[model samples]
Target: MGRLEIKSYEKIKEFLSEEHVGRIASIDENGYPQIIPMNFAFVNDSIYMHSYTRGEKLDNILRNPKTGFEVDRELEFLPSYFSHPTDASQADTLYISVVIKGKAVIVEDDDEKTLALNGLMKKYQPEGNYIPIKNNDLVLDEVAVIKIVPESIKGKYKIGQHLRTDSRLVLAKKILKRNSPTSRQTLKVMGFEETPDGLKMVDEPVW
Candidate 1:
């Protein structure tokens, strides 16, 4: 648990968002850590995770909303790292990761709760037949939605940011040349002009 400084809130928010599955960590009865992977939504600068009213995740949060959560799109695992003669510190296995710590609260507002659920469905089931989230007499009590208010969010982008500026530039291009949203992100981080290549490699690379 290192101290995480906030960089661009938007960058980390992008990783926190986008209809992706994320994990939630809480404390269990023995005071040990409990983590669960779940689908989530983000709105109003708050992170959202929901489940049935009962479960380890729900129980822990009810007792304590403070928790840790994370979402990341690994840029590259590299499988291994090597060094050339000139660069003794040559590195490998680059990745883009974002970690967050915050207090999670269950959303109580009827409209907000409904909107949060809608956001989830649109992202996860955009093409499937629509399933509406509502509080009819039959379904209101059984469904529950939880919201996470992040006190601190820190993104550790190891995409060779620690490498020499020259090396970082080269790696950014390698990602950009392939081009995709991920590559486009790499380009933007490197302050490079983006092109059509970024869109092409969108599926191939993770930023």
Candidate 2:
């Protein structure tokens, strides 16, 4: 119900690193925005993504480097009845999101490309089953690494953190009762800890 801005830079970076997919927007020849959802890695204060050597998104970026990128995780969906039995307007969702305005460029340096690709592999495949990437690898010729240097970043979240203590506890219990796959993580995000007694508010929401 309240607009809670996430002001912590560390938390924003954590969220971005954990989120599986991010949407990147690029302006087309006709000035329309073309958006694509792809896997990403956050490394060295920039966003890195690997793609085929040629595509519409690459074309757009070459024409105009300005871009927008976003990553978000939807934690829970609270129905209208959670607040009011008959008013649909009371429905709300819990989520954490980050947005960035940046300039994108196709990475040209071999060592940087190797670093970015290896960073992505580390994020997506932490098991260490594959060989590390090298600058001189022939595979580099087939893949294009896009780097986004962020000009501005903003993060926001909503999880009943603005509610009174008692009201927030009640909402947490309701979420637990529903017991969806994301319930525990959602409760954790809302600052609840599980104990033998039940869920307890141990701290403020992390983001």
Best by TM-score: 2
State every prediction's TM-score relative to the real structure.
Answer: 0.70, 0.96
Model 2: per-residue Cα lDDT over 1-207, one tens digit each: 235888889999999888889999999999999999999999999999999999999999999999999999999999888889899999999999999999999999999999999999999998999999999999899899999999999998988877888999999999998888999999988989889999899987645
Q: In angstroms, how far off is 49's CA in candidate 2?
A: 0.4
Expressed as tens digits, the lDDT of each residue in 1-207 for candidate 1 is: 232233667766776665387888998877999988889887778777668977887888888878998776655433222345456455455445666789987767777777777777776787969668774433545668888888877776665545566665566656655554566655554455545653221221223
Q: Which stretches of model 2 miss by more than 4 angstroms?
A: 1-3
- Model 1: how far is 96 from its true place, Å? 2.3
**Each model's Cα RMSD:** 5.8, 1.5
The clash number for model 2 is: 0
The CA lDDT at 156 in model 2 is 88
Instruction: Write down the worst ten-residue block by lDDT for model 2.
Output: 1-10
